[model samples]
Target: MAHQFSLAYLTVQGCPPPEQIEIAARTGYDFVSLRPIYMGLPGEPNYALAENKELLRQTRKALADTGIKLLDIELARIHDGVDVKKYLPAMEVAAELGGRHVLSSIWTSDRALYTEKFAELCDLAKPLGLTVELEFVPIASVRTLAGALDVLRSVNRENAGLMIDAHHFHRAQDKPEELDAVPRTWFHFVHLCDAPAQIPTDREEMTRILREARLYCGEGGIDIAAIVSRIPAVPFSIELPNLARVKELGYEGHARRCLETAKAYLAAHPRPQAICCA
Candidate 1:
C-alpha cells in the first residue's frame, strides 16, 4: 500500500481548524493533524472547538465538505500541576469529528507526576476510541526514545503509542537502528521533517528551529529514508514549519510543496515489507 500523508497543523499555523481542513483537501492530503487543544503560544489562534459549538460545527462541516480525515489533535502535555481531565473535552471533540489519535508529550521533569498523568490521559481517551501517541521532544522531559519507552512500559496502556518526529530523533541523537527494538504495536504515525546537520545546543535555538524553521522531507541533512524505513508503514504527517517558505509560498502553496517533496522522497526510497524484528 502507498504511504498516506497528513497536513500537520504546524505546517499552516495561522489557519483555523475549518480552514486547515479545506487547505489539506486542496493540497491533496489524505489526513489533517489539528490543533484543537490550543497551546496559547503567542499569536496562535485559539480554535476553541471544544468550547465553541459553532466552531466545532464549522470544523465538522469542513471535513464533510472536503472528505479530509482528522488524523489527530495535538500537544496534550503531561506537565506539573496539570489536570489531565481538562483534555477530555478536546478528546470528545476529536472523537466527534472522527479523529483517530491524540498527540501528547511530557513537559514535566517530575517522573511520578508525568507517569501518573500520562496514564490518566490514556484512560480518559480510551472510551473515546482515540489512541494517545506520545512524542519525545528534545526540549521536553521525555527527550529520548528510551525514556519514552520506559514510560510507555510503566503505563502499559493498550491505547498508548509512540510518535517519532524526525527533528526530535536527530536532535536527541537517536539512531535509526535503535528503532528495531521498539514494539511494532506502539507505532501509530510519525511527524516528518528535516533540519540542518549542526545540532543546536541551546534550548531557545532548538525551540526556534522546531517551531519555526523545519525543512521539507529531503531538503536538509536528516536521513529520512533510514528512519522511516524502520517504522511501521503508517501515515507521515508533514510538520515542516518554515516561516520563510510560508511567507514566500503562502499556506496552500507551501503545503503543496511539502506533499510533493515527501511523495517524491518516499517513492525514491521504498520501505522494506518487514520492519519488525519479531
Candidate 2:
C-alpha cells in the first residue's frame, strides 16, 4: 500500500490552520494534523479555531478548496487541575473539520488524576467520532512507552490510542520491538520526524531539540523505518520543528524539504511485505 502523509502543524509552526492547509496541498500532502487548540506557548501563533469563528471558517474553506482532509488536531493535555470538559469545544471543531484523531499528552505525574482525566477525554471525544491518541513526551510526565502503555491499559477505552512520535520514541530509548505488545487497534496514525542520535542529558536541551531542532528524516541518525514498520501502516504526520531551518528555508521551503527527505527515507527503506502462503 502507498503511504499517506500528513503535514503536521509543527512542521510549519508559524502558519495558521488555513495557511497550513494551503501549504500542505501545494506541497503534496494527503492531509493535515493541526493545532486548533492553542497551548499558550510563548511566541507561538494561536490558531484557536474553537474561539475564532472567522479563522475557523477560513480554515474550512482552505481545506475545501485544496481537497485536503484533517487527519487530527492537537493537543488535549491531561495536566493537574485540567478541566477535561474545556476540550469539548475544540473537539467539536475538530470533528466539524473532519478530524479523526485528538493528539494528547500527560503533563502532571499524578497517576490517579491523569488516568481518570484521560478516560474522561476519551468518553467526551467518542460522540464526536474522534480517537484520543496519547503521545509520550520525553520531557513530560508519562515519558516512556511502558508508562504510556500502562495508562492505556488503565483507561481501557476503545477510542483511546497511542501516537508514536519518532523523536520521543528514540529519546526514551524504546525498542521498536516493544510496540509488538501494543494492540494494533490502538494505533490511528503516528508523528514522524528525526533527530541526532546523541540523546541530550539536560531536560532544557531535550525540550529545545524537540521543539526547535529536529532534523529531516534521512538526514538524522534515527532508525525511523524500524519504529515505523513495527506499527500498523497508518498515515505519517511529519512533525519536524527546526527554527533555524525555517529561518533559512522559510515555511514552504522547510515543509517541502521535510516531505522530500521523509519520502526518500521511506522509499529507501520500504516496509516489510507480508508473505503469501500457498
Highest TM-score among the candidates is held by which one? Answer: 1
In model 1, the runs with Cα more than 4 Å from the true position are none
Shift of residue 236 alpha carbon in model 1, Å: 0.7
Worst 10 residues of 2 by lDDT: 269-278
TM-score of each prediction: 0.98, 0.98
User: Deviation in angstroms for 140 in model 1?
Assistant: 0.7
Model 2, TM vs. native: 0.98
Q: Residues 1-278, candidate 1: write the lDDT tens digits.
A: 97898999999998888888999999899999998888888998888689889989999999999999999998798899999988899999999999999999999999999999999999999999999999999999999999999999999999999999999999989999999999888898999998998899899999999999999888899998999889988899999999999999999999999999999988988888777663
Q: Give the TM-score of candidate 1.
A: 0.98
Each prediction's whole-model lDDT (CA): 0.92, 0.93
